[model samples]
Every structure is written in C-alpha cells, then in structure tokens.
Target: MTMGSGGSSIVVPRNFRLLEELERGEKGIGDGTVSYGIDDGDDIYMRSWTGTIIGPHNSVHENRIYQLKLFCDKDYPDKPPSVRFHSRINITCVNHETGVVEPKKFGILAKWQRGYTMEDILVQLKKEMAAPPNRKLVQPPEGTFF
Candidate 1:
C-alpha cells in the first residue's frame, strides 16, 4: 500500500501497472485526441498527471484546449483515478465544485478495465462534449478553471 498526496492510503500490488502507464503516456497513444504526462516529470512513480484534450473539430468546443489533472493513487488501475479539470467545463459527468468526474455519470470510470489508459478517458470525454445534450450548451470562457 502507498500514501497519496492528502494522506490517503491505497494498495499497490507488485504489478501496479504504473510503469506501463508511464511508457504509454510518454510514447503517445494513437487517435490524437489527447495527450498526458507526469505532472512532475522526474517522478516515475508519478502520482500526479496533467492532460490536454483537443476540442473536437467543427463543434462549439472547436479550437479550444482543455486541461485536466489526474491523480493516480496506489489503487489506480484496480480503481479509477481521481480526475479533475483545471479548465472550467459544464458537463453532466463532472462535479462543478470539485471538478472531479462522477464515476456513475461517466461510464469509463464506473466500468473501468485495466487495459483502459488515461488516453481513453480523455478521448471519451471529448466524445461526450459532442454528445447531443452537451453539444448545444454554451461553455464557460476558455482557461477558466473550477
């Protein structure tokens, strides 16, 4: 088990899969939908990560850049990481006050699989932004954070 930033503890097995995540993050995943890296590059056990998602083409979110932070605890992979947006966004799946994604509202978080990487989550979110209900809604100013 390992401790998180705020004194939270999580279980970390021998096959934590963190190294796998790091390599995947560094090498770049396909689709060009998103990109992520350790928040503090020097730390391989990288608990904090920052991600960017390119707004979908020809949409209200087009040409916009969304920034997010993902916190992976020792229980990550086994349990979904805590995801928050440093950029303000009004979507059903996100908590307005905390910027935390709602696992129940976000399918990937509720039904997480080990094979799913942070890229999958970002791509899925970009898809969600274009979803019918979200697509029509006006967004807050860019760079506005929660």
Candidate 2:
C-alpha cells in the first residue's frame, strides 16, 4: 500500500477488511456500487468515488439512475466521507449555511461518525433521494454550462 505523506502511518481496523480490498484495487464486497479513485494528490486513500442507485425500485426515483460523489479525508476509515449528488436534485430543505443538499434539514453530513464508509453513505443518500421527505420542493438553481 502507498504510505501517507509526512511519515504518519495509516491504521486499518480488522473489521473493515473492505478497506484492504480498496487499497488493493478490489471491488467492494457484495455490492459493486461502491468504488474508489485517487485524486490529484495521488493519495493512497479512496479520496473520490462514484456510484449509481436505481431510485427505490418503486418510488418516484424508481427506474431513474442517480449519480453520487464521495469525498474522503486524509484520516479516512476513521472519519466519514462527505457524499453529494452528482446530478441535479430538487429539494427545498438544503442547508443555506453550508450550501449542502440536506433533504431532512437535520444535517446528516455534519453529524457523520468515523465508523461510516462510502458505501454506507451512498446507500443512505439513495434511500433519501428515492423517497424524499419533502417531494413537493423545487430543484435547486441549475448552473450555466460552459
């Protein structure tokens, strides 16, 4: 495995063996939806990832493919990754303060725990998008395409 900069050793827990698979470029266990990639820095950690969720199988998002992005920190595995929708999502409960998509307005990202993983977060986000608590909300303003 690639070592972290500054000579600081990265600790891996035995329970989360998937981390090793990720480090070795193996696909996630059970669900291939979760994957990893290196960012511009070439860090050995799963700094970025992408996945698609099939709506909710029967909900509004059913049959719809939803894209997602996961940003991992240097101290990953011990810290939850920040996940966001790669595609446009219409929701009115977003946090104006952080400019993040907060459908529940409960600030789930802000309350992330170290035990969380990219797969875990993506699963939760898919569930929320499929059956949003506030379905009547309008989509966020679209950005101009260059």
Candidate 3:
C-alpha cells in the first residue's frame, strides 16, 4: 500500500500495520498527534511523520512545545524508526549519525524495541524532556540542527 505524496510503497504486512497504528495514534490513541506522508509512486517505503512533545514538568522545557519527526524505512517494525527533535532543543545526547536527539539519560531511545509504536517514542521523549538526567547540560553547537 502507498500513502501520502512521495510515490513510496509499503509492503502490506509490517509497514501497513505500522501505518495503521500511526493513524490510530493520530486519532487519540495516545497523548499527542502524529501526521504521516509517503511518496506517490515509489515502492521504497520511506515514510515521514511529525508530532509534538509537551515539555516535561519543572524543567526548562516544561510548558514549552517541541516538534518531533519520525522517519520509517521499508524495513520498519523489524527495525526501529529514526526519531529526532524538529523544534529547537539544545542537547548533547543527540546522535551525530542520525541527527535525532537522544535522551540517553533516560535510555528510552537507546532501548527501543520493535513492538514500540510512534506513540511510545513520543511518550518517552516527553518523559525525558520532563526530567532530563543532566538538566545543567548545555546544548550542542549551533549548526547541529537536524
């Protein structure tokens, strides 16, 4: 099946299931909202999703809104989704390779499992922002925006 506007095609089983979960989550299955996009004709299965993260309580990010992006490949579900902070979040734990902000202090992104949904990742990111282990840590260099 294909979704969105990139011509990307998703094989029926795993990728389709993940897409369904994303739709459900957008419909209020979880805390935040998620939006998805796919190419028009390609079968490569590259999907992109956007979501919001409510800053954690009692922290610098608390009450502030953050944006998140999720990139899923054709092999999704079998492999974890690539997640990153879309809004300006200054942090050091972000993976230099994938450009996704890593809340290593909480070990959530690092411990991602296949059964995890996009909602799970968003929730974990919110938890990490709410109570980061190193609140005093400074954001990485200015050009690190992904």
Write down the TM-score of every candidate: 0.82, 0.57, 0.65
| Per-residue alpha-carbon lDDT of candidate 3 for residues 1-146, written as tens digits (9 for 90 to 100) | 44656877654587567657656754664434333333332544647766676666666665666666777777777666777776667555556455576545336556766666667777766665545563444544433445
Best by TM-score: 1
Q: Which pairs clash inside model 1? A: none
Query: Against the true structure, whose lDDT is highest?
Result: 1
RMSD of 3: 8.3
Query: Can you tell me which runs of candidate 2 are displaced by over 4 Å?
Result: 1-18, 21-43, 92-99, 102-108, 132-146
User: lDDT at 4 for candidate 3?
Assistant: 50
Error of 3 at 80 (Å): 0.7
Q: Comparing candidate 1 with candidate 3, which one achieves the higher TM-score?
A: 1
C-alpha lDDT of all candidate models, in order: 0.82, 0.51, 0.60
Clashes of 3: 10
User: How does residue 37 of candidate 2 score in lDDT?
Assistant: 38
Ranking by lDDT: 1, 3, 2
Better of 1 and 3 by lDDT: 1
Clashing residue pairs for model 3: 5-39, 6-38, 6-39, 6-40, 7-39, 7-40, 7-41, 7-42, 8-39, 56-130
Estimate, for each residue in 1-146, the C-alpha lDDT of model 1 and write its tens digit: 46899999875552456766668877876766688988886766668989988788867788889899998887777777889988888888988888888999999999998667788898899998888777767888888888
What is candidate 2's lDDT per residue for 1-146, written digit by digit as tens?
Answer: 23589987665553344455356334443454334433433544546665555555544554555565666666565655555566555544334334355634534455666555555565666556545564434544443111
